[model samples]
Target: MKPSLLVLTSLPDDNRERIAASFDILYAPTHEARAKSIAKHGATIRAVLTNGTTGLSASEVDRLPALELVSALGAGYENIATDHARTRGIVLTNGAGANDDCVADHAFALLLAVVRDVPQRDRATRDGIWRDALPLRPSVSGKRLGVIGLGRIGEKVARRAAGFDIDVAYHNRKPRDGVTLRYFDNLRDLARWSDYLVVATPGGAGTHHLIDAHVLEALGPTGFLVNVSRGSVVDTDALAHALKSGAIAGAGLDVYESEPHPPQALLHLNNIVLTPHVAGTSPEANAACVDTFIENATRHFAGEDVLTPI
Candidate 1:
């Protein structure tokens, strides 16, 4: 018999059909009727597929008496009650390496956009304004690039940087034992040494607002900042102030302090580029992420250990 599962995010017909063959999926009731559905059928659920923002909670875990696994469709599992899951003996997993390449590509894209002032340039050209300000745009290649958090995605970002002939340095909790790349003892030090500072750290209380005023100042007026990591990693108000006051050269952000709400502070600035939190969005990344959940679910129900345990 297939184990029963629930999906908070709607998948395409192909992915949905694939999973349906292996699990008895519990369709999410209407938004207004969700509470009623959980109350009535929570206990029978054995698996749940959700994302970081819309995570499975302590109360929801308690309600699902038979739930053995909880999986996130991306790298983050922030809102999920990890402490509660640990106590309840429920296995938790996420798509760790799956979306890494896609996210790394976005990080570079954002970095290039800010350093070259692509957004402002495009707008000016479209509005029939050219060479009036014809402001200087910095060269991306042949500069020192500082990467914060050298994880799988960070490594990928570095691999691409090599093609541009940019020297890469990184700051991690502790320096990696082997493999080349200068290591900085602190993030502030890395910012000071870098022409471009790229943040790829994880999001959570530990890393919340890690890039504050001091780090921004360290980046200096000629430096560029790009964040493809979690929003909480950078202080929005401080970043805006830095850009406005010209304390930092410019910034490029794919994620912000507020997920859905636009970062109003950045919108008005001609020196910045913003995108909705879609850094890890790509067809390949999406499929691989969902496949991780399917594999985790299958392993859990088959009495095997999880692949990417959290």
Candidate 2:
């Protein structure tokens, strides 16, 4: 008999079919439906397929006593009560490199749109306005780029910056191997040196509010900021103030503090570009994520070690 699995969120049709070919895939329509499905069918479910943002809870795990594996596509696993699951001996894994290129692409897009004032320019063109009234926008090429938390995603962002010929410097716990990229001991120092700052740090408490008023001030009035990482990494109020007071030239963000609900103040600002936290989401990334899930799940159920734990 094939292993049974439950999909907590909707996936692309192609990915769904891929998963279905290996496991008896079942979809849950609602939270309540998920609980019901697990209670009714948990005995057969060996795996759960989910994403980091829409994570599985401890209660949900308890409902599926037979479950041995939990999978997330994307770097975050905020929704899962991991401690409880760990105690129960259930393994957890995530899609780390599955969407690196896609995320780097979106990050650069946001950067270009903000620095070049693309949205406003397009709107003016649509409203029968001309460039005579608009101020000159900054160029994206050949600027100093300071990237925070230089992990896999951060490295990807830097690699893209190479094409633009930007002076790239990054901050990580330890220096990366033999790379020519400049390393900064402090975030403030990095900000001070950068004309444009890109945040690619991890989310959670250790990095919470890492970009406070001081960092914004260090970035200065001529500097620009971009965050393709977590919203919690930035202090939203400080950022809004920075934008309002021209403490920084402008900003571009793909993620926000409130997540599904973007900040109310940002709605009125034209100095920034905003996206609904979808930097890492794409058809290609989704497929890779599901493929990772299948790899880990298959190994776990076959009484072998899983791939890429945590």
Candidate 3:
């Protein structure tokens, strides 16, 4: 018999079919469905597939006595009860580098869109507004770019910046080994030094609102901020105020504090660009994510070391 695998995310039909070919899928993408599926099939479920946002909780983990693995289909596992799962001897894995290039691509798209005022320009051009009527936007090239986290995605962002002749520096809890890019132990210092700040850090309490009012002030009137990381890392209220008051020139965010719904405060602002948390999503990325999950789950069931253990 195929191993029972509980799925908690909503996937496209093709992706769903791909996974279902390998396991007996529970297919609970909604909240009520999740609860009902767990209650009814708890004992048979040997693994649970979830993403960063829709995490598996401790109570749910406890209910599934047969669960041997919990896999996050993306790099983030912030909401997953990792510690609790650890205590229960459940293996955890995430899609760490599966979408790194895609995320880096989106980050650059946001950066260029905001810095060049692409959205506003498109609107103005459609309105028959001449080029002279628009205010001058800053050049993205030859600027100091600060990256908040220098993980795989962050490194890719830096690489993209290089194509534009941008200078790159980054901040992490500790400096990454064997990188020639300048490193800052302090985040505020990185913000102060940068013309554009791009956040690629992980979410959770340690990095909650890592970019706040003080950091914004340090970024000052001419700087730009971009967040392709978790929304909690950048305070929406603070960003809204900054954009309104011109504390910073503009911002580009792929993630925000309140998700699924747009950030109400930032909606009316023209100096910001927002994408619906799709930094790591693409047809290619999605396929890679699904493939990574299958590989990890398969290896774990075979008593082999799974790739990308979280």
Which parts of model 3 are misplaced by more than 4 Å? none
**Of 1 and 2, the candidate ranking higher by lDDT:** 1
What residue pairs clash in candidate 1, if any at all?
none
> For candidate 3, what is the TM-score?
0.99
- Candidate 2 lDDT over 81-135, as tens digits, reads 7889899898888877878888889988988998899999999999999999999
lDDT of 1 by residue, 146-188 (tens): 9998998899999999999999999998998885899998889
Q: After superposition, how far is residue 149 of candidate 3 from its true place, in Å?
A: 0.6
Task: Give the 10-residue window scoring lowest on summed lDDT in candidate 1.
Answer: 28-37
Q: Every model's Cα RMSD, please? A: 1.8, 1.9, 0.8
Report the number of the highest-lDDT candidate. 3
TM-scores of the candidates in the order shown: 0.94, 0.92, 0.99
Scored by CA lDDT, what does every candidate get? 0.87, 0.86, 0.94
RMSD of 1: 1.8
lDDT of 3: 0.94
lDDT of 1 at 148: 92
Where does candidate 1 stray beyond 4 Å? 27-36
